[model samples]
Target: MLSPYKVVTIGDAMITMNPISTGPLRFVTHFERKVGGAELNFAIGCARLGLQSRWISLLGKDEFGRVIYNFTRGEGVDMTHVQFVEGYPTSLNFKEIQEDGSGKTFYYRYQSPISTFTTEMMKDEMLEGVALLHLTGVFLAIDPKNVELVQELIQIAKQKNIPISFDPNIRLKLWSIEEARKVYEMIFPDIDILLTGLDEFRLITGKDSEAELENFAAVYNIRDLVIKDGANGSKLYREGMWTRVSSFKVTPVDTVGAGDGFDAGYVYGWLHSYEPDKLLRFANGVGALVTTVSGDNEGLPYFEEVDAFINNELIIER
Candidate 1:
């Protein structure tokens, strides 16, 4: 049965041009066009798991924007709050993948349509039935104004008693570490769930030890602090206890979007009130599945797929 809970997120979606060859993008002639974004991928991940996922954002009234709109709508994500603006262009990025699935992204998102979005567009009705509001640093890094918008949204979510899940998803290309750290600290107190990468946590707090992590969670009063360590697994801190779960071993084709999938999985488990260990295992399975596929959200598994994969019942034919 599909969960009655609704997961909502706001951010920018882009037309991702992925290189066909596994090398420098300069030498690659053929490319495959697809849709990708941090928050958008999270919405898609939630939708794939049979959660009511809503995406709120602005896009250009261009072909790329239309493609993203149609693609996301097809993924079963609610697009009621997504809009298209004039003049500004839809964001875009080209990916360069190496043999080991590591890659780089070159962004061409100047004057992005999302830049036109204002906090005024955010209304109480938007959170009318939302069970969770997920935020990421990707959107907050796009424009200085977005920080205020996110703060406003956080306030609205808090007023409504909706839990907020945050992922730092830090991108150095978009903003500096100093700038990101400042904004993160300002908002960390309000966060109920913090899903962050191990490296990002270290960079943000200057702490690497598990004890420090627990102390950070306690200081911030965060209910759930989730550390996503790619390939190593995930760790969760809640109620003065820490639970660690191992990652599923998989040969990766693309590493992008795995964390977003993990966020969705963790949120899903949280809403269902899964035990800490089971929650981390479920989230780890989702993240591991994402790395096995090439596209951003294509590998985000359905609940049945995740159950099978976690239970060792899934059979992949080569």
Candidate 2:
């Protein structure tokens, strides 16, 4: 197997099926299945950009579960630790895409086989060659036991001197705000780069303005903070300086996984030693490209594609 280029991400890997519909209440028309999870999307996004990435998760022994494993393997993800359980169905998420191709998703993931993950499922040897480890808030929402497992995993990485990247990929439907805030506070100190959005930051920190956000970042011992605002561009707060980067314009095909694409781009830049301005621009470019496609991982670009758009040799069509 090839060595990791920079980062390894850990979380649930699900088979996402989005059914075509004219509206939210409409019945399913047809469905398209894709592999998605915040961390998996981040890993795939990194791999597509020529970064050697790995994803650690669990899947059932069912056909759908095998499909997810095989798919990620084909994406060049190192799958040495993807556990397969007996007699459990893979966690699945269903989406209803409106005529405009924007809609909500409903997950059928409670009590999933993957939800049983503990530190035992993850091996110390598996993390040996990785330069960084990426995690998200979803792993925290699974269960208190799983939360403790994730925390232990991060602590291990920290002790091993591997960089830890965190994204508060906050989903209100998964847990209450108070519960989420309590957990966020517990995990913030262990994070190296905190990738979050305006809504999540405000909800977690109870802060409203940029100044308040900045002050919170300082107090939490966060090394870097990137706030993603869809279409409005992104803000980067690092080393006591703040820079705002404008987003690339695109006609969005779907908004799902756009933030994951953003995280992937930012991580790629971080691994490659790009300057702050360049990193933010490249991340926005990746995010804008993801919006033009129907699936989160489908629209992610290779280096050549991103370079073409960045260099203005090709126009980004809506």
List the global CA lDDT of all models: 0.93, 0.82
Q: TM-scores of the models, in the given order?
A: 0.97, 0.94
Q: Put down candidate 1 lDDT per residue, 1-318, tens digits, no spaces.
A: 678999899999999998988988888999999999999999999999999999999999999999999999998999999999999899989988887867888999999999998889989988989999999999999999999999999999999999999999998899999999999999899999999988889998899798998889889999999999998999998998889999998888777899999999999999999999999999999998888887888899999999999999985432
RMSD of 2: 2.0
Worst 10 residues of 2 by lDDT: 1-10
Write model 2 residue lDDT over 160-264, tens digit each, in one string: 899888898887888888888889899888888888889878888888587887787788778788999988999888988998998887888777788998898
lDDT of 1: 0.93
Q: What are the clash counts of all predictions, listed in order?
A: 0, 0
Query: CA lDDT of 173 in candidate 1?
Result: 90
- Candidate 2 C-alpha error for residue 176, in Å: 0.8
Q: After superposition, how far is residue 71 of candidate 2 from its true place, in Å?
A: 1.0
Which candidate achieves the best lDDT against the true structure? 1
